[model samples]
Target: MGKTYCHPAMKQLKDQQTRYAPKERRLEQVERAEQLLGEIDRTKRYPYDYLCFRITGFRPDNWSALMIEGDEARRDLRQFVEDLSATVRQPVEQATEPVLTVDEVSKKYNVSTRTVTRWRRQGLVARRFVIDGRAKVGFLESSLQRFVAEHRGQVERGSRFRQLTDAEKDEIIRRARRMSQFRSGEVGLIEIARRIARKMARSTETVRLTLKAYDREHPDRAIFGPSTTPLDDDAKAQIYLRHRMGVSAENLAVEYGRTRSSVYRIINEVRAQRILETKLEFIGNESFDDSKAKSVIMAPLPAPADGKAPRRPKAPKGLPPYLASLYEVPLLDREQEAHLFRQMNYLKSEAVKLREKLDPAKAKTAALDKIDELQEQALAVKNQIIRANLRLVVSIAKRHVGPMNNFFELVSDGNMSLIRAVEKFDYARGNKFSTYASWAIMKNYARTIPEENYRRDRFVTGHEEMFEAAADNRIDEHEYESALKRMQEAIRGMLDRLDDREKMIITSRFGLGGASERTLEQLGRELGITKERVRQIESRGVDKLRRIAGEQKLDLPML
Candidate 1:
């Protein structure tokens, strides 16, 4: 411990050692290669190509040249081996952080590639760099830690965080009842919760969950009381009848202490049931029992009871039954019909005055209410008239029954046509309503026959022949004939607006002057001009006439 110091010679030795270390390492590698070559030469059993591959980790294309086959060329073979050793490169091991690919991460998490993609979307993983222009996903070990940390919390499903208390459930039920009453028996759980959530300082989900739990716990409870009770069949049928009589669903629900949804459900159910029953009754192949069938069929007049005059069968309920069934609608006498017509005229006048005074686009609520009221009254009057003339549809339907075979089907079609006739009928025409309706009914029935089947069976017989003949031979009514005459006069007046030459050319060309139609060339000759010039004048005059006709509200399809 007295003096542990390096000498001057030791310092020089350390410098020398450092300078020769790299050269020494290179020499050792060369020595190793020489020993391997010596070993290969001794083992002649192994092919030279195989020896070069094992020693240098590469098989040269020309093993003969690389090996120097003759022993005399051992020096050249050594030189070749040296050059090969210098040119060959050893593979290097790179120090890199371990990465998990999308597939590997999916397997590790027991999930799918889609889940890994979702993690990337949620910023749980960083995008991996591309290799060879191809995109790849590789999550670093540290990124997985972030993913695990972010998704580690326990989660609640559905709308519940904890169990609902008894008091909370009772409160929800009470609020729901109040809401149903306020809405006039038109309440649902969601609607009730939306209204009560604010007052209770809770979410709609909480209120809904409480109510749901209450329902599960107390099955015997009244729940929403009368509003929640399902309607009976009698009540359903009455709802349907009233709805047909023009009551709104909202009003119906309020009157019946039920929800609007329940009202609509009841009405649809009854209508479907009635339709099914009707189809079952009418579409049967079973033969009718005479006594039962007679009772089912309605008569226009029942036989006198105890020598009293006969009376029509009592009016049926609901919609008029199928025409094959008994349904006697009360008819109107001349006096009653006259009174209704007078009332219609007065109502029409009042309605016209109201309509003239009101602007629908800018009307106030009161004006709209008045308009609706008047319309309803007018509709009621029209319905009375339609019901009175329903027999007319049946009478005509009976005449067409031979071809139609299904009497009920004919009656149904006739009834629809009769409704149309009612909508289109003009009381100011001074013609009988029956006369107008007959034409409408006959036109509909003519179209009712299946054209495909009618064409196949070319023969016409029975009432069909009579119908065709009547349609062909019937004369136009005086009202329509007079209207035609007025239309002709209007056309004559419109023509007079043109110059004398134009009027003469148009009248002669179209036979409008009660003469044979003259050709453009003939007119051109008479007028001493080219047919092209005559054609131009004719077009001009026709255009003028069309403008005039449109102004007069004439229904001219050709124009």
Candidate 2:
């Protein structure tokens, strides 16, 4: 407890977590941080995001499910409370109860400082505080009384035990080495420390700290093999994977012959490695850092409670089947559009906030996975918005359709404009999304409709102009032209006999009318059908053409 240990959550609080630091009243935050010591169960591990949410009432931007516990979590939170209390702009007049410094507690209870340290090892809660410009350890009056009431005998007999001398420490180290060396059945430092503590009649923490101090002072001459050495990248990865799979740090500490704190440090270091290695992109918004951002941006969208969505206005009678389907999609009210846009932007803003802290390698499925989850949620919300407004695309397309431009093709182009509008629209401006989308679609049509008409007219010619063109000077030209005409006549005659769908599939597949041949997948996307369905239609059309040729006794090449 005396030595420095890196707590995992402390760095993440400054790096990854969203802090709820209100400038007006930080004393309440201090009180909340103090209350947490009793509320949090020390035995269980918890996600850092969930912890942040509980403390700050706001979910972090990169909401993760990384679980942390044991001495690592406890020490981090204690230091967090310490730092939190230190930052109170005004005096903390409303502390639930008075707190005593380490010296004060020792003097008040007639116990040695070692006994106070031992009391911490025996579950007497203590926190760090900066009082009168000096940082000191303080114990809550309530926590002290609780510890004393429970361990009266231990508290009363405190400091009667003397501190370990150099000889006793050396003897303890010798015993630890002997126990570890002679017994080769996966013995850890804890077992060695406990056995030595029992034989020497000292607290387990005292024995443990003595061995650590010795190893740290003389790194090359360590008692616990390579346990104190920094783990390789691969070993850190393995430990993190096991943690993701629900292995406790305690178990990892035992298996790796390291303290739980060391194991947690490695796990977070690997976490920091992955977060640094990943590439994340997001649209940043100033709204995310606001105090009430999560609640306001993530406000629930209006929906029918019965689970069945009520339809919007019906399409005009005798409308095309495709246009009719568009009308079936429910429209989003103003509230929902705002909610979705805000949520999408907010989610990305939080991710960018997390990405901003990449400089520190002090702390991932949970982190990276949480980022991925946020993206997926944002996408789902975007799609929901796009679908609700699709009828707008059809309405605009109906106006843009010309004799040369296909109605469905105009609708298809309008869809791309609508998607871009959804991405770029700022819902905070308090305007109708459809109005924006309509302008976007018309702007696209303004650029596209003229190009389409010009291309179509460029290839068209009058009959008199065609007749005036000169013929090629080749041998057997008339016979060759006659044969080519017959082949074309046969194909045209058969094409007239098939249905509209069959004709379209055959023409698109074979590149008729000098158009480039289209694959089944491309055609399926354009037709709103599966590739398999397109293939089936093409096959059926070809079979019909072959049967008609056979019945008519027509000679068609490659039939």
Candidate 3:
């Protein structure tokens, strides 16, 4: 053969062409494999194993190709193998571990084999199987130690794991024997078995078997008969009656034939059904009148006395009657009463002046607007009065401080009474405001006091009648009589002390027969003197009255 030396450039070009073709083919294969693997991963289980097997078959017998591809594939395959090994080993590791047999467990705890078996069945202890048909039962050593420690007092004195003491086991056996003996007689088999199981630390079946054995051993001792004095029809009827009347379960059990538990169950069932019925009735009858109830409980004030005008009593000169009585109840001195009366008169006069500034004819046309404005001002004054009344109620309520006293409730009731008094008061009445409010105050106190005793009950009833009568009469007769007497005495005394001009001034200012309470200016015009001169004469008259009062040691009644 001719010298087969190829050109270096041609050799290099051929090698490059060969290498590039395989690289392109490998990249395409990689892309296809990745796409297929992604599809498999999305759709099916065991994609890694499937893909590995598929790729292996695709390049069968190609060692170089397989080795190159296998390096990348082997990494994922190794991970899959590790995962599979863990899955397979977990349960196997759990199964092959040395577990205590039921007998061994029973012996360790000094309990019967049957008790261990029951514990395994109840999942209180872990269980395994052996080919020999003996169950491998186990509990964690720590758990076993903990259980032993918890019940160390009950364990046998000489036993290693502190299993049941011989004395305790013997006592349990004795109780079981007693229960088995009872079961052999006419007692309930299940209940007797359960009792034996609890006492012996064994299964119910074991107790039942023991009971059967006992019955067989002592056939002559075993007595069988129906329960004597079972619940009769009359007893059942009495139970039903008691249940219907809402008797307690314990009481019902003592009286009736059923157990306390049974009575409770029956009563609860009935109560639940009754509750359902009540709910249904409430839903069906949805005609409840909340407004009607409110109206009945808190009735609105009666329409103003006359159809054309609101009933507003003339402003009184002294404290309201009710307030005066409340204050004087604690025995306020005459000077204190007079001071309070003068302050009240000043407030009333100011209110009257404010009212007079508004034109009456214009007010009639814009009555609603005027009323709203007036009511706002009135509300502010009323709030002050309410605060004062609250204080009075507190004082009055304190007087009732003793056993069975509730000052807050008494105060609350008094407040309501005070509100009613304010509503019904006719300011036009010449009596002191406190006297008019007295009935309301007493009514509030009476409502809270129990009517158990004859004296208190009679007083409460009479007071209620008196309130009703006063409301109807629209005039406080007692107050009117007192005021009339006071007025006569005051006029007589003043007439004796005053000169002619002073007498006329006093009489005209008071308007003895009608329209009482004239201003200084009005009196000045009538007496042909400047208002200043009239004021001086009025001051002199007041001074003379005070001198007389001081000399006679008499306190003038609050005007």
Among these predictions, the greatest TM-score belongs to 2
401-427, model 1: which lDDT tens digit per residue? 652255556778888998777666554
lDDT of 2 by residue, 338-381 (tens): 77788887877676566566333444334554554565567767
Candidate 1, pairs of clashing residues: 298-326
Q: After superposition, how far is residue 499 of candidate 2 from its true place, in Å?
A: 41
Error of 1 at 477 (Å): 60
Worst 10-residue lDDT window, candidate 1: 1-10
- Comparing candidate 1 with candidate 3, which one achieves the higher TM-score? 1
lDDT of 3 by residue, 49-76 (tens): 3453443333222122222133323223
Rank by TM-score (best first): 2, 1, 3
CA lDDT of every candidate: 0.54, 0.70, 0.44
Which residues of candidate 1, in runs, are more than 4 Å off?
Answer: 1-310, 313-321, 324-327, 341-361, 403-405, 428-430, 450-452, 455-559
Which is the winner by TM-score between candidate 1 and candidate 2?
2
Q: What shift in Å separates residue 306 of candidate 1 from its native position after superposition?
A: 23
Cand. 2 Cα-lDDT: 0.70
Going through the candidates in the order shown, the clash numbers are 1, 2, 15
| Decoy 1 TM-score against native | 0.26
